[model samples]
Target: MVAKKREWRSGRRSVATKLVQMTRHLVVCEGTETEPRYFGGMKDALGPANGRKIAVVVRGSGRHTLDLFEHAEELCRIAPDPYNHVWLIFDKDDFPSNEFDLVERKCGEVSSSSCTFHALYSNPCFEIWPLLHLRYTTAPMDASSCQKGLVDALKREFNVEYRKNMDGLFSLVDSRRQDAISNVDKLDKHHKSIGNDRPSTMNPSTRVGDIFEELGPYLDKGD
Candidate 1:
């Protein structure tokens, strides 16, 4: 990941200096390689804090489904400074429906005044997110199909092959972020229209855009 330098500044030097509190975020991902690499790229893109107003920490636990959510909760509890927001990222790849649904439910129950928890899940697989940057579809896909779609889309759009742990993956798709977010909204509406509310049953669906929406201000603009 390429690092960028950023400067923090207050409006102006005044007789009375104002203190700015940094907003902290903790993102725990289930996949130890792919998810971590993508978010690590995000952190690098946001650049060095340099005592900035936002601080983001990304971690990957080699756990699945509910276990990943529990790990996130535990990490939040032990952090020196309580996180303002905690996001758990996981995929619904062959996980039992009950186990998948429980994590989303648990996120709602564990939120408090100090910290808010959000479940950012991808049905089938996380590859759906990158694929959305290239095209939009409402077709249901399993893990294999989702990855195949990503491979085709990457080759078609970027002339590159998709790899699970590809370095700088975030930068590769950063330019079409708005397109992905728009597709996510459409997919969400499609699921709702069909009366599909459960994450496990919502094939071809992903809430990954929720994290992007929350961290929009801190993200680097793409050309």
Candidate 2:
């Protein structure tokens, strides 16, 4: 006997064909303040473009990198509708190399199923990614220097002191969005030419712009 396929009905119309699918995103950040405020604004600034409502769920629970990864997994487990993508943002400020490597591996493992769990990481701090928005610099700096430069630049350009929980932070650097992405790519190339094998360890380096660009399709056109 042949098996019949079950139909999903939505008031007489097939639900699958009648409704547009939106890509749900779960983004857990290591920073409870800075990352959420920035990414939340980024999410809020988007609209349903290309028939995709890019929804980003930013979780800021003061979790570390590994814990953040686990949090994203937990979200996927608990959410009735699994997210299309799960992103764990990380800052390798003082984290050990083992932890960093382990987190990356765990994300890789979790990404094998339906959901794609991505690890978006910054070298020293998340501030470095935002600092690239202000100016292009590849100078090697530690965590403290990165934070100081970011704070100073924000104060000078926007006339606002760098606060972790500042709302609408994405708008402040929205105009230079492309520039920030360009700077990140340029910095990576610069590092490669200089014999720096580990770009992530290169101070002021980040793949945050990559995630931004992925979400940019829905962002730039609408806002």
Candidate 3:
């Protein structure tokens, strides 16, 4: 949203203007529990924004693919304040390739000067994100296979059980946040090299780290 025009009485008008320029982000996820819980923990960990420069809101839609994209659009449409960025987070899963790819295409169509929509997807499932923290693998996997991989990785690496709705899941793997981001980038390049540019065809890959990359500078350091 554009800042209101103001007549400043104090010498700190520039500082006040900076506060009004705060960027707001809306993250809409497909899963009702797991995705929301993981991202919610990240929001908490980010704490308060410095000088109110950034604000993040995370919501779970209990929807998938194109439906999740529509839900995100509606949320932004009805939001009291306009969001500077809207992120649609979902899984490639077994959704038809055409439908899976449509969301990313629609993101471009719906974007404008005021807000930009991004389709950040995980191939197979969201569990791939957590699994990346422990180790990186380019092997293609389906939903069940990805979940099994995560379970094995968690048990082997941290001696912890992987639960679908586990609390503090973010904190459990926060230490390796950078590693996960790096691995995701590597996986992305691997897919590109193999001519697998479509989101639906990029197995065992995720763009979830893109959100973290954008928000890294605004994260609260006190935590």
Give lDDT tens digits, candidate 1, residues 1-223.
Answer: 8754333354544356778888888989998899999998888887655138678888989898889988987898789888988988999998899999898889899888878899899999899988898899999989999999999999988899888899988999988999999998888899999999899888998888888776676775421
How much lDDT does each candidate structure score? 0.86, 0.78, 0.86
Question: How would the candidate models be sorted by TM-score, starting from the highest?
Answer: 1, 3, 2
Structural similarity to truth (TM-score) of each candidate: 0.89, 0.84, 0.88
Model 2 score (lDDT)? 0.78
Model 1 misplaced regions, further than 4 Å: 1-14, 49-51, 220-223
Let me know the TM-score candidate 2 reaches against the reference structure. 0.84
For model 3, the local distance difference test gives 0.86
- How many clashes in candidate 2? 0
Q: Write the per-residue lDDT of candidate 2 for residues 1-223, one digit (tens) a residue.
A: 9866555342444544666667788888887788888888887777545235556678886887777777777778888887878878888888886676577778778776667778788888888888999999978887789888988998999898877678877999888988898898898888888887553456768878777656886776672
Residue 4, candidate 3: Cα error in Å is 32
Check candidate 3 and list the clashing pairs: none
